[model samples]
Target chain A: MSRILVDNLVVTYPLFNRAKSSLDTQTAPLDAGEDFGGAHKRLVRDRRGYVTGVRALDGVSFRVEEGERIGLVGANGSGKTTLLQVLAGIYLPAQGRVRVEGRTTSLVNINLGMSSEATGNKNITLRGLASGRTRSEIEARRTEIAAFAGLGEFIDLPVSTYSAGMRMRLNFAIATAFEPEVLILDEWLSAGDAKFRKAAAKRMVEFVGQAGILILASHSASLLQENCTRGLWLDDGQLRFDGPIEEVLKAYEQDGNRLVGAAARA
Target chain B: MTPTTKIYDPHAARGVSGFLSDLWVGLSMVELWRAFAWDEIQHRYRRSALGISWIVLSFLMFVAGVSFFFAGFSGRGVESFVAYVAIGYAAFIFITGNFVDGCQVFTSSSVWIKAVSLPYSVHVYRSLFRSLLTFFLQMVVVIPILVWAGIRPGAVTLLFVPAVLVYLLNAVAVQYLLGLVAARFQDIGHLVTSIVRLMIFVTPILWVREGLEGARALAADLNPLTHYVEIFRAPLLGEMPRSTSWLVVVVLTVAVWGVVAMVAAAFRRRLPYWL
Candidate 1:
């Protein structure tokens, strides 16, 4: 069974000052009291008053079980990606307990390691190997991936020549090619035209219907509502709401509107 | 029971076992790094008419030009001097290449590092393999030089293989050490580039180590690089390497790995955040 349990997770990432990170400027001028606004209140400073790091995820907790389709809604840099990455085992949380039980595949970024200079066919080989596929395994699925992408002759050409929609087709096809008990995605797929969309929806149904887990982060309300039964709304690295998709999306929209109104008045 | 469940905790570390497992996993994924390294090589020379011959061409140019220019200064026969320059220079290139490549191995692969959850040793092996490929290519010219200089393969020459294995062994440790340090601190990258360039001169690639009488001799003796070079060069030239060189290299390998184990243990989990 696919399951995820995260408890009181805290992830703090270091933020080195530009001058301090540069080779020429080893000893940089100190920033004594540089303050950032809003969500950045979680930034940590050293005893010497220099900004040390930012608490990307602070005390966030969630649990996921089989057959649950979760839609994560959050503003940019609100730690939606970080949470997804943590689940994907890319970044380990600094202080927390996380247990993931399943073969988890994270398509967190569509173009995570895509090389523009390599052909669509070559990319399939590259991605397959990078994700731990052996030569024979990649060869077994090469033709299937090419047919799914529908790039045809362009599969032999470098990705640089492919149209944006075509590139997305290849990326989506390659990522979703393999089946997994748990899959994480950064955004909902809305690639190509009606035919591709129909195929993608079918693929999604097949995976979600297999007693697996799907955690998707997207801004589109309709997409989330159509595919996901539950929602997780994150605000500034904190879980603001978790419930039915309708209620979570409602709360998220209201918060956005309230912030807009507050800004207008100021 | 399902065998697929995996747990990751940033705060928890398994110390030596974790490091060993990581190395094992990365080494097992040979196809991953090998494919990427091959692709990188193809991209580098894909458009050129000479293709991968550029490595061989460059090696030939450097060794030929240097040997001819400095042949009289070797205080040795011109024929012997030629092979010595060819082998010594190639070893220098290989050693220095590993050092320079080590600094960029992790930093260059930051995209993959952030996107995927693979062992950090993958990049280490990838960079080392790239250097190894170039070193193999440089050998194309070295063989001809050896043949021309009348050095034939003998039982003593078999020692060259293990001497090279020692270098590769050292390279893995050095790569993990330098790759991690340089990724965390940008200044180390610059420092490494400078030190690598300085190493070219400090190492006796063009100059022979035979006639140095005083401090020069002591410096050569102290330089671990001199030992590494001697271990490889002495065997290929059908001479036995000094026991001191072999002892220094083995001891240094253990010491460097000891340091790498501690550093990697402390910072392996923090690698993603730093990038």
Candidate 2:
């Protein structure tokens, strides 16, 4: 069984100044003295020139169980991407804890490690390896991925020669070729040509069907309502609501309209 | 069925074990690093007509040119001088390549570092393997030079393999230490390249170590790089390396790794943020 439990998770991004005066500038500057040390003394918040950290996820916490397809709804900079990255094991949290079980496949950025100069066939292997697939595993699924991508002759051509939609098809196919226990997606499958979209959606159904846990972040409420059974609404990096899809969507819409009306009145 | 929990704490593993654990995870992904290394080699020469022959061709020309020019000045035989320069140059390229490019290993892969969940050592290994591949390609040039110089190897020649392993280990330590440092301080990459360039001249690559006498020879003996070069170059040149050179290299390897462990323990987690 798969599970994800986030306890008071806080992720901070340190903003470094142009003059990086914190650490020694020479060989293996190993946290010598003042920088990133000092357990008892509090960090210097504001000084002449020092690193400043931004709290991207400010003490947000949630639990995700097996077979729960969760839709994460939030505005820009509402920590949706940050939450997904944290779950995917990309970003390390600063102040709290995150526990994730089972093997995970992240589609947060499908084009994460692609080389445009390489052909689609080469990219299939490259992307597969980048996503933690072995050579034999990627080889076994090579034909299946190619058939699903339907790039045909273009698979032999450099990705630079392909159109944007074609590139998206290759990326989508490579990502969805294998299913993991936990699947994390940042957005919908809104790429490729019209005909390819139907095939891609069919592939998504197969991928999602096998996944024990699915966390999707997107702006489209209809898509979430159609796919996800549970919903999480975030406001300013805080969990505003976590409930059934319809109820959370209703509450989120009400809150958005109220803010818009208050702005209009002012 | 019951659910399993895997807690990921940013500050969980501290000190030496943290470094070892990360190294273990990165090394576990050997296939990934191999693919990355092969991809780099292919990408570099994919458009060329002769492909990796360019490495051999260029190296051959360089060793020949340098040996001929230096033979005229040093009064040494052309064949022996060519063999010495070829072996020395090959070792130099391998060591210096890892140092100069290893600094950029993390910074160059910032995209993957920020997005992927793999160990940071994966990037370090990829850079090292790419340099290794180049070194192997350049080794093709050494065979003909050795054959032409009639330098036959006995049981002592087997020592060359172990010497190479030590060099590789030291390269890895330096790469990990320098990779983390260079990521935080961007200028360190350029600084490393400049230092390596200067060291190439001082460490006796083109010039023979015996040419310098007395106090000048002591200067070369004091250089750590001279010891590393001697350990590898001496065995291939059909002479067992001095015990002092072997001792210095072993000590240097341990010392370098000691520093690497400290750096890894302290800054391994903060590396992504710095990038």
Candidate 3:
């Protein structure tokens, strides 16, 4: 079976301005009885000017089978978005490896290189080509894509004139035009009014049906339950759990409540 | 008998070859670049009655004003001063526009950079292409005037070819380094613009290099913009560039800045968070 494997992935970010530590004391002089005034002053001075790194992804290992739909659930700082970016080949893993088996189209930011000053038609061509559609294919499907966006009169108007919802509609339409073997979606898909939302959801489901492998990162558990068979739970750059969608969702809900309760208690 | 055909999967593990293939896919994003260039041009001239011709008109007006201004000071004839100042100003504008705009090449598109999975080099290339398009448009305004002034075109004008390529390469290097630094520092973007403004006067754009005094001559020669201006002007004006000096500048530019670019790209993944 075809699959995508990410082995022991680690992404570390170096802290900028390491010298700020040394300079901080210079900016705000330590008081005589402050923490630095005690025995800890020597330790603080010694540690200054040394680079510290934040581990954004730590040994994230996963294997996604072809044609499987997976939901990635996590908190704000969790590695869900990072994992999707790594799979899309945007960010290289600092350690380990990622191997994929098909053409991937990431809907991470549907309007990713689209110019606001360009027309909807222009953005359609630009976004479509970026998503891996050939020029001929984009030309062939131009009408259908424009119609899908439902911005008929405004198609030729600059996208800066288009409302936020209208732009998102155009982005969603162009992104879904090309069939991708591996499809990745970030949280930006949940825009538009009720009517447009229904249309977008239907189109998303259709795209996922044709997608060989799908990974979606969203905070909405209900959406995951409806779309994904498997779920991966991430927390603080670590894979906390991976299992059937229902099982992981249940654990996630409880874990979220526990954190909320602890905060309330404090 | 029915034949079994294998479908090509772009995601398959071809190792380093796969990465290179993906890079090729990224490089094929020239359509995106063209679209952005069109967008920039359209946006700049959107509401104007003169429209895109204003790009040419403005450049012509600039050359005219500077030509007259410098002619009186240099004690040169109107014809020769116009040619010299026009060529110098035109080349300087192209080089500085490319470099200054390139400083925020990625930073200006921070949203897109954070969102897209394409190669970071695409942004640099797009900025360079847009600047080149504007430069070409302005050259249309300058070229006819040069021809009318009896400055006949020569084989030296061909030097523009390699000169443009080197300028673009240097712009890419600068963009890559500054893009990362700007992402981190945030203040560097404003600082770059200020430096560009200062560089305009010091680079001899409105005057001949020979008109400068001793200390000024030494300073101008040390300015990277001097080498770039010489590279383009030497050929278009039928003069040979100082090969040794130009060579040193090119080598230093590529080597010193090239290493910084590699380091920047190596750490580019952290940029989104830093920004």
Candidate achieving the largest TM-score: 1
Question: How many collisions per candidate?
Answer: 0, 0, 3
Q: Estimate each model's TM-score.
A: 0.93, 0.89, 0.82
Give the per-residue lDDT of model 3 (tens digit) for B167-261: 76777777667777777887887887898899878886776786677988899888877887888876776677888557866787769465764
Docking category for candidate 1? medium
Q: Interface RMSD of every candidate?
A: 1.6, 2.5, 7.1
Q: Chain A TM-score per candidate?
A: 0.86, 0.81, 0.83
Clashing pairs in 3: A67-A212, A100-B11, A102-B11
lDDT of 1 at B122: 89
Q: Write out fnat for all predictions, comma-separated.
A: 0.62, 0.54, 0.26
* Predicted candidate 3 versus true structure: per-residue lDDT over A1-266, tens digit per residue: 23688888877655655534433544565553242213223222235445465566778888888668899998886778778877877666667878876666676765565777788888778777666567888899899888988998899988888877887788777766776677788877655576876787677677666646778888887678877889999877789999999999999999889867866886
Model 3: CA > 4 A from native: A12-55, A109-113, A190-201, A256-266, B1-27, B211-216, B252-265, B268-275
> What's the lDDT of the predicted structure labeled candidate 3?
0.72
| Clashing residue pairs found in predicted model 1 | none
lDDT (Cα atoms) of all candidates against the true structure: 0.82, 0.79, 0.72
- Positional deviation of A76 in candidate 1, in angstroms? 2.2
* Model 2: CAPRI class: acceptable
Candidate 1 error regions (>4 Å): A18-37, A188-197, A264-266, B1-3, B12-14
Candidate 1 local lDDT, B1-275, one digit each (tens): 24377776765545877888889899999988887788778778889999998889888888889888989998978888888888888898888778888888888888778777788898888888888998888877888888999989899998999888988998899889888888889898889889888887778788889899899999988888899899999888888989999999899999999999999988887888877
